[model samples]
Target: MRLLVVEDDRTLAGLLHKALTQEHHVVDVAHDGREGRELARSGVHDAVILDVMLPSMDGVEIAHQLRAEGIVTPILMLTARDGLPDRLRGFDAGVDDYLSKPFAFEELLARLRAITRRGAPVEDECLVVGNLVLDRRAHEVTRAGRPIDLSLKEYALLEYLMRNPGQALSRTLILERVWEYSFDSFANVVDATIRRLRKAVDEGYEQPLIQTVRGVGYKIKAQ
Candidate 1:
């Protein structure tokens, strides 16, 4: 799953990024709260790890604004302030979970997993279309009971496609949501990735699940 980490502390942010990436998660980092809020509004992440103290805007306001704007992605707030009132305020601001400072890495990971499980009602633990299955938790993909190996980006793209089965997702929409790029930016990259993904997911299958919509884009044809 893709995650957004909003932290101003450079060292801590770097550590979190490295650790999460190692755990097979695609991570995007923002140094300030404004940038963090913008990233959060993109509606791409499964979960967000946000720090309380921030530049331009505080984490509390970020969470509050996100909720007010109807962005339901689960947020795990990190802060050194562990007082009861502070925790309540974090909760009031729409943070799903709170982690105090100087926390163990294991605890953080556990919290992340827990919050992400409750991230969205539509994002099931396993995504399926016909015989194609993508296990979100195990990070495994199978087509007709045959295991398929996929790189992290390919997996992300496939997951996005599966989530919106049969929808004519434009290239711009795919690039923005999956690649996090603006319209028509990196068009070739999107094409290349789609080609690779098709080969991996549909090469020997009798029915190709991934379909192109001519000038529109691609979709995982619903069964």
Candidate 2:
């Protein structure tokens, strides 16, 4: 499962990122509310770990807007406010669960699992970008009706890109999502895999979909 952690405290966010990655979930971190809302709205993540009292917008408002827009992705809010009114407000805004701060990591993990099990979002099995098609259920890739064979890493990279088409994904983010290691030394692995994936998906095609975003990373878009 891919989880989004929307937290302002960098230390806690990093801790959550590390622990969740170790638990085998691809994690994305956003320090501000606006960015968190944007990522949560992407519909690419299995769940979100949201923090209340965020800049630009609060977690409750974010949940309200997403629910109003008809996004059913599960949200687990982390907040220090544990009053009955606060809890009711959170529920009214459509948060799946709430965890007060200074709580146990074990409890957080448990609650996250529980909510996700009950409210898992249903998504389309096929991921499409232009002529490229990736069938998640079949675990197959095709472009313009031509079959394309990919290694495990290549397929994951492609799926991640296709899941967030038109968005620049940094090398660090890609490494975190596609590979187990989040260290900087493994950044080159992403570049090497991208090259191989590019060869497989775009070499023979006109109007290639894979794009190199200078000084940032890569994005996939329909030509």
Best-fitting candidate, scored by lDDT: 1
- In the predicted model 2, the residue pairs found to clash are none
Q: How well does candidate 1 score on lDDT at residue 100? A: 93
**Pairs clashing within candidate 1:** none
Residue-by-residue lDDT tens digits, candidate 1, 27-98: 888999999999999886889999999999999999999999999999999999989999999899899999
lDDT of each: 0.90, 0.86
Off by over 4 Å in 2: 119-156, 161-191, 196-223
Q: Which residue ranges in model 1 land beyond 4 Å of their true spot?
A: 42-44, 117-123, 183-185
Candidate that scores best on TM-score: 1
TM-score of 1: 0.87
**Candidate 1 C-alpha error for residue 159, in Å:** 0.9
TM-scores for candidates 1 onward, in order: 0.87, 0.64
